[model samples]
Target: MGSVTTSHELFEVRRIAIIGAGPSGLAAAKYLIAEDSYEQLDVYEQQPEVGGVWFYSPEIVGVTPVPHTTPRGPPELPIWPKGSPAPLFSNPMYQHLNTNIPKPLMQYSDQNFDSQSRLFPSRQDVQTYLIKYSQDVRHLIKFFTQVADVHLVSKDGKDHWELTSRSIITEEQKTVEYDAVIVANGHYSVPFIPAVQGIEAFNAAYPSTIIHSKAYRSPDAFKNNKVIVIGSAASGLDIGTQISKVCRKPLLNSVKTSSELKLEQENKEEVPPIAEYLVDERAVRFEDGRIEKDIDAIVYCTGYLYSYPFLKSMEPPIVTNGRRVRDTYEQLFHINHPTLAFTALPQKSIPFPLSEAQAAAIAKVWANKLALPSKLKMIEFEEKRIEELGDGAGFHVLGFPNDARYINFMYDWVKTANDGFAKEPARWGSELVHLRERYQEVRKKFVEAGGQAKTLEELGFEFSLKY
Candidate 1:
């Protein structure tokens, strides 16, 4: 919030500053470079290399460690400290962790996976792809540089963004001005740990016994230990199952709290929500009045929060709370000053392709080739969205079918804007759209079919039902 302007005319955006060198940042650089209007593009990344959260670092340093807590079972990761400085280290990408989505669905619109790669590639494969993509626009990136602050300055009836960055090694500070800023810093670093009633007592009794999933690196560390995995989401289930192979007895504590909980039912599976912790007996008490003793460790699979400490220093802070951003139109451009800044497309959508579409669309808007909805219309959209989804988590959460709608909007915009009017920014073709639709259709059918069927040989059937 620098100088308030009454005019909504398109401003000439020649120089752009992109924060973070992750997929979104790289995609922004790619599209902006493709457009001839943008002359100078700068990408700032905190890490020594290109991959933002994908690059796995062995050492755990400069991290905002999960604080102590007390709970019935294991403690949740503490709330992200608002207005706090960025940690020195990055989020952990465990060794055996693989992509949850298939390679075909996760690939960028313009890029393809390696021919020899598997369907669900490893984290290393994704990091490699990001690195290769970074190489395509390496000239624009300033490695080992961290963006400290971004301030809005109005000069001669126009808005300009001034970004201050510091080198991680030498600690030298420098400030540069740009016509626009793209917050490409992805939301995987700062963990969102829930609070528990008796977590502090438990942590004091058993030091280093409870940890967040971000601290988990390998199953070897949990071997012969009695582990309790909190949450039943993808990471929680996958990590718990992996540790169960080596651990003495690993219990999966699901907060789903549903009577209709459906699972294959492994040997040591318990489905009660945690009620409280028994510090005296060092046991876990569930809501069902059952007590579990001799529990060794707990792993929290709670996700990360969208924390941008850098934006707090702005004239008027961009992030209102831990929940959502303020005055963002379509979750992309700033409603008041559309030209000043934009938060890259968010939610649980296909990362690379969604980023590609968003980057292209943003480039169009910055180039004055495309127009956004009226300010009143934009505010109405956000209000209606919050009404349907509720506040905070509900607002940002995008499920399967909803993701299709969002991406399709970007695709449609790219197509409509390029209809013989302005030079076309790279278009996300029908191929990607078709892939999402077909993937959703197949997934729906598969989910409805429920658990996997036994092989024909095991069932002793003459013919398969799939045929």
Candidate 2:
């Protein structure tokens, strides 16, 4: 972590810039707008509209080659002639994707999913909900503008941010200064494909034979082909199930451990991680010495990297190994420079309401309505968290009860700073925590019953004060 001297004087943040108009960015905007202190608020979104990754397009970007040893940086921007279309960045949403978390738990604190939405909302449904939520702050967003760089600039012995952004359509570039910056840009863009032996030769022999989930749109092209799906995470399980239906019998599923092979479907066979790829034989050898030959395609459902090419200029780098962001206190504020904050970095938890909680804390702190702990204390908190969670992706994971506790912690933190004037963020009670805990089980039942249930009560699940 970087070190900085702590000052007792509060830094007056009047102008703020938020990157990415995703769920977290929208939440940040809502909370910041609610505070009457900020003189100007701007949101930079690369996409022409909001919804972030939920905004789906049929177009698929070219896949990064297999055996990616280092973190993948941002794609180079093309210089398009006037009136030419801007480049498209693909999201990792498949055709049949549905929310794993139930609607009640996935929704933002201020709004509800539509009455017609299913228990596990589809991609379109969630996109619609986010678009609706972003209505109030739409004016603050600069669509089709990509933030190219954010670096610290010193003026009057205080640190400020210089943001440079490019217009995706016109290729025009501009630079601006802000008192504070909120990095709500998501971490799900760059795909992380583990390095495997002979992967480059295999790709050369059979081009497009391997792909990350980010490039996958549908299983139609994989029909009747011998497929191997890598990783046992959420996308792996979902995409494996979908591919198994149309592909050959006994789809090879590769996982890190026996515990990850949860699905017991006959068409899917769990195998150990890949030991090597035989380029000549079009085969893969598992760690258990099992070999599968003539494989048609290998889909890496492995997750994405925590990439921020725009913040590359910052000293004491924020991202390392593409697994975690460093120097963050409570996984939100930058320990050395509190003005530069990040939200929606944690995984294995619902994102909507969690983003609201984080945004509330950031909004209050920047508005001088909330006071953060001293720099030394904040550094101590980071050190303590690293001791408990280690220094990897686990540091950002807030699973089960920990996630619930975090939400309430932020809610209470904001309340303490409030003078009964600021808007409150989400505070999960016992009833909501119970719902969040059992949502996976309830979703399973809903799927088994042909996914006809629209509400939790329809599936025999209801909220109770007592856990």
Candidate 3:
């Protein structure tokens, strides 16, 4: 219900509609407001609340907690009130849930959490952090509005967009126009439930036990009961890891969850070639051999698929079969749809603070180009590379081959994006360790067995520093 834009904010913005009030959308609003760039910015988020996907958890069955030994990043900042509405997922998670990312690496370049914090912050703690972020920039957000659809509009010879939205609180539909829109509405809104045979029949025969990991809040859902968790992604691991110590034998249907080939078990070496198909033709079964039919619960750690209903008509959809649209020059902006950008999406990595810095770089260049600034029109290899990449080839966010993941700290990637290349800002600051150390100590270890080395030379990195 808050937006930083006063009645007179000295912005040329017509009217902008942001479709989600989560981190990315809120971040964008902060920039637009603090930078005094937008004339009017209104964010629409369904569910009568903010924190979209992190909104709620509904219990069904088989979802329980086990020992939580998963690696973590930093804690989340809670933005929601302690006494929100229904939706058990809305309740605070157990004390053990932390990010898969480490604290030092995930902190924004401009700020760091208190030094006395844990290595990775808990989900609730991080939510509290986001709440702080929201408070700091509360004037930039509007909650309880869900965007239904948007249509492109052309006036005279110029193009603009008309957005259609419904205020859940007011129960009123409204229309607005904008010069640009940033769809911070992320993927994972809908669960990716697998279409395994007999699933529907199994549900009919034994209703209410099947559910997705998103519904799981705590082990309270599975006390003195056997549980089953599917999917092998981070969430799957987190949930399964938690439920394992509790569930009699939390059966898992290991599949192509991780880009890497390692399957980690507590106190066990990472396993390889994870079983693609469960042996009994059933993802989970019970001991009585009731045709493998009944179970206390079945948690589909089933991964989520990225979707953009707005971009449905964009020819090659932005994502294909759980994979992103092919080819990105700098791996940031969409090749074919230059006006549209997916800032925080990753290929094989989790969310990190680096995304914010990267988003800022893209935004600067984008604003300059839109306003026809000469600084952006200059000649350079970086620009050419970006232009070449705009050809619609290599239009993927996961980088090439879709096998490995990489994050270069050079910041030159964004340089290639806007002016074709330039030195990163010293104000951007440096991490605890140099880029060389990151590569030698971190990057090299993540490569698959037969991967090739991608150094500054190959990456068009002209400068050198310690690793």
Candidate 4:
């Protein structure tokens, strides 16, 4: 017997499974396909459409505005893969919701948001743009499918792994072992509804009115109703604002009152894997039968969890601090599971660009699997922050450095871009491109806020035109 059954074989991966089909997943598919690395590709999405987290994601569905506000009909469908449908972003959306950030600032920098478009295009416009992006790269995905689990195995007694996926359609499960797996499922899959103390009794009492933020789409259902919104993130705040206009005297920011007055509420149940509880370190409590000023609906805009039900089989535990997927710096590789990687984890603004950049960089070093930043450093950072903050709750947005927020993203984009998989633009071409114009337009606003402005001449710009 020649060395028994040897691990001499090199793994041949024919297909790669990219989860979640949102901006991150779509971008990954675009790069992998455009790179021509794998012969076959599959994209698993829980949503019917291609816009992950945008096409009415479970998190932001509460703020998706009212339905069909467009004067003109929806945009024409883009050219997709034969039998594969066009993106859902092209569908009509509610009118009240406008992009919080301006469109020009939000574009991929390489892609234009149409010159005739509004500064802050409606949610519908963003969706349409996403749909167009998917159609342009439609050859790359298999939609309406989902990944139930992914495991790293020593198949054939080798260093390679097999990937197992389950389709939501036909209730069929399939396995396609890949040399690599990209978990692009994103974060919004599991809605983190804070189950308060009386929540059980309340639902037992008012089952019809108690709704998670995920199910909410427009105010039409909430009109004239007394609403009580929970949490204070952008999602929660936005819902409260919307309901205030439509509902009668919405109790805005009532949940935040505990923290505002430094009143600590005791023994509230915490949501696991995410250290923070539904109630803040400071919480709101009332006597029996007094449910916060006679509110009819309690909209739980409590946010999302870092849910990877697929990773339940993996041992050694992936420890997460609050909303963050911790122990992994920059939220990429794992300290334990080296063969697997996840995308769509946002450390800060415009998470897609940064995530795409990081993934592409890792792909170059794909063979160097299990390469993690030192565990000691990771442990040190986490402990230090846990000590400083006293409680690990919500996003640590400014958690990194001054330059890291943008630089990390720009760096990741270079990998596939350099290989011509994605367009490699010389300049970052972010807001910096419009810096001078922006400065000229808003210098007054900054000065009004007791700030000083440096002119182009002073800031080292030689201008041709007279001021």
TM-score versus the correct structure, for each prediction? 0.83, 0.95, 0.65, 0.67
Best by lDDT: 2
The true-versus-predicted C-alpha distance at residue 3 of model 4, in Å, is 20
What is the Å distance of residue 89 in model 3 from its true position? 9.2
In candidate 3, how many clashes are counted?
Answer: 41
The candidate maximizing TM-score is 2
RMSD of every prediction:
7.1, 2.6, 10.8, 10.7
By lDDT, highest first, what's the ranking?
2, 1, 4, 3
Q: Per-residue alpha-carbon lDDT of model 3 for 1-467, expressed as tens digits?
A: 11221112222335556667766666655555544444677766664445555444342323222211121212111233357453222322334566544444444444555554544555655665566666665555656555666565555433456777765556588877775666777655435665554456556555557767655677666665555666665576666666765665534444443423232344112122222223334334322222332357777765455556654444444555543433333445444333344555554443444455445544544444222122222223225644554432222334322211234442444444434333232122233333323432332232222122233333232333211
Error of 1 at 192 (Å): 1.1
Model 1's alpha-carbon lDDT is: 0.67
Worst 10 residues of 2 by lDDT: 75-84
Candidate number with the higher TM-score (1 or 3): 1
- What TM-score does model 1 achieve against the real structure? 0.83
Give the whole-model CA lDDT for all candidates, comma-separated.
Answer: 0.67, 0.84, 0.47, 0.49
Pairwise TM-score winner, candidates 2 and 3: 2
On lDDT, the stronger of 1 and 3 is 1
Superposition TM-score, candidate 4 onto the true structure: 0.67
Candidate 4 structure quality by residue, lDDT tens digits, 376-430: 6655655675566433443345422322344445454453333433333223343
Q: Model 4, residue 45: what's the lDDT?
A: 71
lDDT per residue, candidate 1, 139-252, as tens digits? 878877878777778887777888998876677999999998999887666566666667667777877777888878888987897778877666775677678778885355
lDDT-best of 2 and 4: 2
